[model samples]
Target: MDVSLGTVFVSEIMGTAMLLLLGGGVVANVILPKTKGFNSGWIVITFGWGLGVFAGVYAAYKSGAHLNFAVTIGLLANGAAEYAPGVAVTFASTMVYLAGEMVGAFLGAILVFLAYKKHFDEDADPGTKLAVFSTGPAVRNYGWNFVTEVIGTFVLVFIIIAFGKTPSGLGPLAVALLVVGIGLSLGGPTGYAINPNRDLGPRIAHALLPIKGKGSSDWGYAWVPVLGPIVGGAIAGLVATAYVV
Candidate 1:
C-alpha cells in the first residue's frame, strides 16, 4: 500500500501534534499554578509524555511514525531505503518529515498554551512558565547539560533502533514505555529533550506566543538540545547497523 509524500507529511504532522499536545499539556498541568494537577510531580509528566508517544506513533503510522528528526536521521544513517513502505528515503522525503514534525510541534505547543491560558496568566515564575513550553536544566552548566542530553538521546535512539529490529507486537506502546523510562531514568538533567523537533519547535512557539509574564525562551542553551539529540541519534543508527544484528 504505497502512499504519496504529501500524505506522509500530513501523517507526521498529525501524529506529532498529538504527541506535543498531550506531553506539553502534562507539563502545564503539573507546573503552572492554579491547576488541578499542580505539583503532581515528575511521574505524571513522564507518563504523559510516554502516552503521547504511544498516541503519536499510531497517528503517524503511515510515515513509520518518524515523529522526530532524530529517528528519521537514524534511519537514514542506518542505510534505510524507505521512510515508510512507500515513502522512499531521499533528501526530499527527509525534508518533508522534518517539516511536518516541526509544524506539528508548533501547533501542539499552541494548543497547550491555549489550554493552559488561564494558568499562564495566574502569575507564575517566568522559569516555570518557560518550562511549560520547553525544557531547562536543573544545573546551569552548558557542557554537562549537553553531555546529559547526548547520553539520554543515545539511549533513546539506540533503544528505538533496537525496537525496530525486534518484534514484540507491542508496536507504539513499546516506544511509549521507552519514553517513560527515559524520563524516569535520565530526564532530570535536561528533561530529556531527546528529539530535536520535540524541543525546538515548541521553543519557537514559546518565543512567539503572547503568554503573559513569559520570559526569555532560553535560546542560549537551545543548541544543546538540538545538536545533542542529532548526534546521539546518528551514533545510535551507526552502532545499530553494526551491532544490532
Candidate 2:
C-alpha cells in the first residue's frame, strides 16, 4: 500500500523502537549480572536481534517499515533514478525514518536500563554496563571493525531487497528467519547493526542513562556503524539489480 511520508516516518519510529527494545534487552540480559541470560553467549544476541527485526517489521508494516537507513538509501539508489522527485522524497523519507529510529532506540535503551537497573548497580565493570546498551567490537582495530560491519550489513540489505517484490507481504516467520540466517551465518565478527540509527540511538541512551561508573559511550567508532551500513546496502542494491539478467 502506498503511504505518505508522515505515515512511514511514524512507523519507522514505532518499529525501530521495538527493534531496540528486544535487541538491547537481550544484550542487557546476557551481559548484566543476576539475569537468566547473563553470559548466555553470542547465540542469544544473534537470535534477539533477529527477532527484533521481525517484531519491528510487523509493527511498521502499515506505514511501510523501512526501519534502517541503509535500506532506505539502497532503495533510493536502486529505484529513485527513474523519477526526478524520487531522490528528494527518498532523502527526506530516509532522514525521517532515521530520526524515528533514533527516538525509538533511545526509548528502548531507557526501558532496558529500567529493566536491568539492579543488574547495572550490581555490576562493577563500567565497560560491561555500557556495552549492554550499545555496541563495541571484540577487537578495537578500526579497519576490521569497518570491514566486518560493511560485509554483514551489505549481505543483509542485499538479501532482503533481493528476496523479491517487497511491496508484497512476507510471513512473520519468513522475516524472522531472514535475520536468523543472517545472524547465524554472518554475525560472528561484529554484532550485525545493519541500521545506523539503531546503534547510535541506543548509544545516546546509554550515555544519558544513570549507571554507576559506566565507561565511554565510544562515539569515536560511531560513524562506522552509520556509514558502513549505507555503503554496504548501496553496493548490495546495485549489485543485485545489475545481475538481474
Candidate 3:
C-alpha cells in the first residue's frame, strides 16, 4: 500500500486545499457583509472549522492525513520513521510534505475568495475581510498570543498522538471534535490558529488577491502563528513520545 512521493504531494495538496476552502468559507459566510450566515457568532465558526478538518482528513488519507504541519512536525519530533504506512520519513519527504501543504493552503484561500466573491467585494472593514482569510488576535498581544497558540497546538498534537494509542475507532472525527473544543475554549484570544498553514497560507492569499479594501495582511503578527505552532508541535511530539504515547 505504499504510495509514491507524487501521490503524497498531490494528496496533501488536495486535502489541505479542501481544508482551507471549507474553513475560510465559513468565516466568510459569518463575517462578510450581506451573507446569510453573517454575524452568526463564534459557535458557528468553530463547527465550520471542525467540519473542515473532518473533510480534509478524508481527502488526505493517502498521506495519513497530516494536513496540518504541526501534526507532521510533531510526528517527526517524536522520532518516528514514516509519514504514512509506506512513506519513509526523510529530509526530502519532509520538504515535500511542507511544500504540498503550503501550495494547497494557498490555493484553498483562493477558492474561498472565489466562493465569496460578492461578499469580498462588499463594503466591510478591511480587517473583517482579512479575518475571513486568516486569524488575528482579539487583543493583539504578541507574547500572550504566541503562548495561546503554543498551548493550543500542544494539546492538539499531544492528543493526536495519544489518539493513536487508544482503541476507539472514531479516527478523523475525533480529531475534528478536538478542534471544535479547542476553538470554543482556546480560540477567544488568538482565534486558535494552531496550524501554521491554516493561518500563513491564507494570509498570503489575502495579501496577493485583488479584493476591494482588503487592507493590510497583518504581517506584524504573522510570526506568532507560524513559530508558535512549530514550537508547540515539536514539544508535543517529544512529550507524547516520552510519556503520553
How would you encode candidate 3's per-residue C-alpha lDDT over 1-245 as one tens digit per residue? 88788998998999899999999999999999999998999999999999998999888888878878888898899887888767888988988889889999999999999999988888999999999888999998999999999999999888888767211223878989999999999999999999999999999999999999878999999999999999999999999888963
What local distance difference test score does each model get? 0.88, 0.73, 0.89
Arranged by TM-score with the best first, the candidates are 3, 1, 2
TM-score of each: 0.97, 0.90, 0.97
lDDT of 3 at 30: 93
TM-score, cand. 2: 0.90
lDDT value for model 2: 0.73
**Better candidate number, 1 or 3, judged by lDDT:** 3
> Where's the lowest-lDDT run of ten residues in candidate 3?
161-170
**lDDT (tens digit, per residue) of candidate 1 on 84-176:** 777888999999999999999999999999999989999899999989878889987999988888888888777877767321123888889
- For model 2, the superposed segments whose C-alpha errors exceed 4 Å read 80-88, 165-171
The reply for model 1, stretches above 4 Å from the true place, is 165-170
Query: Which window of 10 residues has the lowest lDDT sum in candidate 1?
Result: 161-170
